[model samples]
Target chain A: MAIFRWGMHFDPLAHLRQIQRELDRVSWPWTAGARRIGGGTYPPVNVYESDAEVVVQCEVAGVEPSDLDVSITGETLTVKGIKKPLPREEELNFIRRERGSGEFTRTVVLPNEVDAEKVEANLRDGVMTIRLPKKAAGKPTRVEIKG
Target chain B: MAQDKSVKVKTTVSAAEAAEDAFSPLVDIYEKDDGLVLVADVPGASKGDISVQVDKGVLTLAAEARFDVPGEAYSRTYLSFEPGRFFRAFALSDEIDRDRITATVSKGVLTVELPKAEAARSRKIEIKVLE
Candidate 1:
């Protein structure tokens, strides 16, 4: 039995990647520059914001916790890590090698000001989730309307 | 010669079975003295979300990510792809000990160890003088 199915025949994930590639090409006319920029960003990330905080999740499989470094400055969050390749025997032959391993650094700008001191991060099952608490002053205040 | 022919046939059959909607997870296969180890990058797949099965000399991996965020995404800068399910299969030959195969999932990576059958494993042979 097929465990997972999304709609009749829609693959949003693949389509999204295609669109992202096209956008990259348009922004960077130089194909070589685009390729170099793309290769460095090893893991893809998703950012979401709620009323109280902004959360970022990054896919970083095969990366050891010791090799990961996360830092925040002003409204920017930076994640850096190194993914080491698995050990192989001399006689071992690889039929397919799709996963790339190396050092990667990704920095994202937050939509709102956050309290960097209160930021929290956790790495589980190859996904790193970082939560940045929005500063109290940064939240929108509602004024009372006189009737 | 017969084994080689069968292997070629299996490869073609699997190639034809690839589907459009299914995304193949990036994988690295390594051969060791005991067996072959396949490491697959399946980010967002937790422990209970992944399944490994062997049917008719074929090994298949299916994984789905559990991502249910309450709020809408505000921005997407560098998303290689949206998080979703992934499927990949490999045609295992008769040399593999299907029963002894083992799998483990950790930090979004799946490692499958397919041990070679007794007859397929390498064994040093000793020769003595005929005298």
Candidate 2:
């Protein structure tokens, strides 16, 4: 939906934001099963939130650092990368294959506004962890009522 | 549950604590002309923490998932994964060279290589022509 008005620019990530909200309402691959739903969604993710920051963990086994791309755009954090396969010898015959390798784009809409300047990401043991600190306005505040 | 305990019975139990008291990690099995390879996805486990064993013609993969993050979650929003043990097993064929089997962990994925036995591998017999 587009609203033509002053200072009301068309939001491109609005649909992604809506999907993120729906994913939160129900159990995901972790609760269900770790099956590859699609080509791009191979690496499943889990999110954690605290008062200060939001930590995002992505399962990226067999993915290298050189193949990863992490960026924050407005209310969404996107991860683009490729999962590379191992080298195989000649005349190799496969009997069973369950793993997959391909390029993927995973975007998560953050619940709170984050400080992009302070965001940091690290990859280890086939898992990537990203920490995004919440902005002052995004942090929760306790309001006091006086009699 | 059937207590068949047979090798053909793919007791692929899901959810928790069926294989040696741990969650069964998903695996990919493929075969080559020489042998076979098993790839398992076990994130959050270090190289030293993961273990692979081939005993009694059965292969097993085990890893300890770690939580490096600190602080309790203020509110659970999208909690999908956690730190725990991953366990899975498979029955191997007799053609495999169990003595030469090896395993390694990289980027939290465990790869196990099982070479075929000498007698089991197919060899190209050279045809001798008598003139």
Best by lDDT: 1
The DockQ-based CAPRI class assigned to model 2 is acceptable
DockQ by candidate, in order: 0.27, 0.33
Q: How well is candidate 1 docked (DockQ)?
A: 0.27
Candidate 2 structure quality by residue, lDDT tens digits, A1-147:
111211223468879967874674465533322222223345677667778877888888779899999999886888999987657633446565566777888788777789999999999888899989988764577799999
* Candidate 2 wrongly placed segments (more than 4 Å): A1-40, A88-91, A138-147, B1-21
- The C-alpha stretches of model 1 lying farther than 4 A from their native spots are A1-40, A87-93, A138-147, B1-20, B72-80
Per-model RMSD to reference: 11.7, 10.9
| Minimal lDDT window, size 10, model 2 chain A | A1-10
* Highest-TM-score candidate: 2
Question: TM-score, each model?
Answer: 0.70, 0.72
Model 1 residue B30 lDDT?
79
